[model samples]
Target chain A: MEPGSEREVLTLALGIAIAVVSVVKRHVFRGLPRARRLGIAGASMLVAWTATVLEHLVFFEVLDTVEHLAYFGAALALTSWIVSVPRGFAEPRGPG
Target chain B: MNEALQIAASLVLLVGLVLTPRARTLSVPARVAVAVLFGALFVQQVLDVLERHRVAWADPVGDAIAGAVPFLWGGLLLLMVDRFHTRRLSAQRAQTDSLIDELPAAVAVLDAGARVVRTSAGWRQLFPSAPLDVPLSESVGPLPEALAAALRRTLADELRGAGDAERVPGEDRWWSWVVSSWQDADASGAIVMIQDVTSRVHRETDRESTQRLAIVGELAAGVAHDMNNLLTVLQLHVESMRRRSGSANEASLRSMEEAVQLASEMTHGVLRLAKPGEDEGRAQVALASLVGDTVRLVRSTLLRKYELVLTSTGRPATLDGSATRLQQMLLNLIVNARDAMPEGGRIDVSVVATEDEAQIRVSDRGPGIAPELLPRIFTPFFTTKGAAGTGLGLSVVRGVAEEHGGRIEVSSEPGEGTTFTITLPVGSHARVPQRRAS
Candidate 1:
């Protein structure tokens, strides 16, 4: 495998693993409104990684453009989610 | 346009990472993970921008940074989720502990190892010497042995019900407790709930004593009534003998009549005790004259070991009450004062009349009541004088005062003398003459 292909394949595997773990522990995201936005960011990153891996095989200009767009989407989602997160979201809440 | 959008997204992400309030509470590792995630994403975006502009060196660097984005993002996601879960659980535990601590009843939670894990405010009060994280048996103060045993039984799943009232070994306090075993998926323990029942126990005992006293009073009243009738006949015979006899026999006959009169008065006193609230013979009685008369009567009956002084404010302190009952109430107080000063101390009896009320104060220079015993002084069957006292004198005084729409108050210092003040409402009729005590 080419050096570029190797990096793409490794990135693809890691992205898939993250997506799988998230699916398996889906309950952790339940009731967390911020987690939905986080899930969007993670999914977009996975899409970008998939596009990168596919570009190594098919070598299309559109695939490369798609990869950049997906990366931009992931970054935008993550930034938006962080900005919108309420103050003390990380702070422990008192029991009712 | 895509390049500009990518750069703007990267810059905003970096700014959000810096400005977000969520970043403030992030743990060290979580903060580092987030920073690294943003760094990798920024590098990927920059390298992509450079590569799009046909910089040959940017290809390799862009590929390397791009491959790390997913890995860094994934790591950050997992770290934050785990931290949130842990913090939520900890907060929930803290809330539960706070709720338990504020519970009104004394409660304690013990682990399976019999170590006390948590306690309520009431529990802390009840066992101030008992500290947390210690076994029950190793508590500092005299831990009620029964409570410890109950906890053990609960933990063993042998006893899950309430225990009887157990007296604290050295203390007068009583505690009733309930112990139950509690188990969840992660842990098993016993929840012990204790209630202070000392007051309730005292109330129960007092009720029983009052009931017994009522029965005894009824029996005594019946016997006294019969004896009173016999004494009335004996008095008639003594009077007849006195009228028919000469001066030689008059002294002995007069003594017999006086003995009969004394016996009759004793029976009437007993009858009054049995029916204290009877309004049958109530009349407007002059208190000053009554106090003087009672004082003289007491002076004549007892040995003049202690000086009995009587003073009356020259105002008419009259009451529309049974004169016999009023005299009885005054006599009980004076006699109690006399008994208190067994070693012969001065007894002062004073009658003072205000516009609305009349006060009869009997003070004795006796060893005053202990501060602890002062509250229960007028409680029936409660006494400092053990065998020699029936414990009914002060109670009768209070009863009579209350029955006549009055109140009795007492003040004492341990070393100083004690004073009993009975205040009665001044009756509407004040025409009675005030008599001075000799």
Candidate 2:
């Protein structure tokens, strides 16, 4: 099998695992405090973005500056999620 | 254009979430949903940036990023279920807490191990030192232990029942514990309600004591009636004998007559305690003579320098009541007066008869009762004299006055003296003939 093909299968498996974890621990996520919930969500997004980046890198021999900058934008969103924890989203949960 | 606008709205929302203090109170799940919403929008922009850059190494990597989007949606769905489950449980807890607090019965909800999961306000008050998680035996003592054990056993066996009445050591409460099995969606336990019945036991004991006193009184009155008859016969026989042997051993006859009279008075005193009211026939009593007689009975014992004085007007004054009880009431008053004049004082007993009622006032020149202590003086068994006083003297006086359809009034000054005035209702009865002892 080709190296790129192997990487493709590995990324697919990684994506499937992340999906399973998100489903299983979804209730737990609802109970976490605001800072912690946002932190975990941001961390998970960073992991998913990194996994996708590795998948993108499998076919190319080298990277361009424009793509690096675009990747930097994804990093910036994850950073915002981390630093902005205290005032994260407001909504009312029913009666509980 | 729509995508660009969504990106702008999402960025604005993200700023609000991070900067505002108002967002802190929001529920975790609610906040998670909002965070997930903003996450999805932010990630979309990242994906678009990725696609626009179009690196040749990509092999449909957007699919992996797309995978994360589904999770955000999945987490929100689970959060909704969690919210419903938690909300119902919390509401039930608050509802039970409020209702059990209002109940007079002390209630405790225990887990399978007999640990207190929750308790009512009464339960908290009953065992104020106990914590929510303390064992039932530790909190309420062994009083609740057997009951809790039985309830837990019922749960273990999947049955339902109650426990017998039990007593808590070192406490007077008689507890009757009833437990119902508690099984809900999440857990199983027992709902124990404990009721105190101490007062009921005390009431039953008092009733028995009262009934015994009544029986003893009846027997004494019966004996008195027979004795009165015998005394009457003796009086007749003595009179006949005296006529037959006139002036021979007159002193011996006089002593015999006095002995019989004394026996009659003793029997009447016995009957008085046995019965009250119409059981003894009422008669006209000369008020002034009775007061003089009662005072003379105890005058010698009065502390030195304390004079016993009686005064009355030859008014149409009479008392219609049991003579024995009236005399007893007057004797009690005399004793109370003597005690008041511990150092030396004057006691004046006077009778004033009106058409409606007759008033007798016993005034004493002694250190008067303190104003603050006056109201409690008539309460039974309340005394300032400690071991020297039975405290029933004034209480008996007030009782007798009331039984005769009247009340006693009192007034006093700190250094001056105290006066007790007893008034009795006069029905359509004639005043007794005047008989005053000096």
Evaluated with lDDT, which candidate comes out highest?
Answer: 1
Model 2 chain B: weakest 10-residue lDDT segment is B429-438
Q: Which digits, one per residue and each the tens of the lDDT, describe model 2 over residues B365-386?
A: 8788988779878865556687
Best by DockQ: 1
Q: i-RMS, every candidate?
A: 2.6, 10.2
Model 1 residue runs over 4 Å out of place are: A31-33, A88-96, B1-22, B51-60, B97-145, B148-199, B232-253, B275-289, B299-307, B311-321, B339-344, B352-358, B370-392, B402-407, B424-438
lDDT of 1 at B361: 96
Q: Output the number of the TM-score-best candidate.
A: 1
Cα lDDT of all candidates, in order? Answer: 0.79, 0.64
True contacts kept of each: 0.51, 0.02
B353, model 2: CA deviation in Å? Answer: 6.3
Model 1 lDDT tens row, A6-89: 887888898898899889878976645388888888888888888877876786667777877887888788877766655466
Interface RMSD score of candidate 1: 2.6
Q: Under CAPRI classification, how is model 2 graded?
A: incorrect
Instruction: Give the TM-score of chain A in candidate 2.
Output: 0.42
TM-score of chain B of 1: 0.73
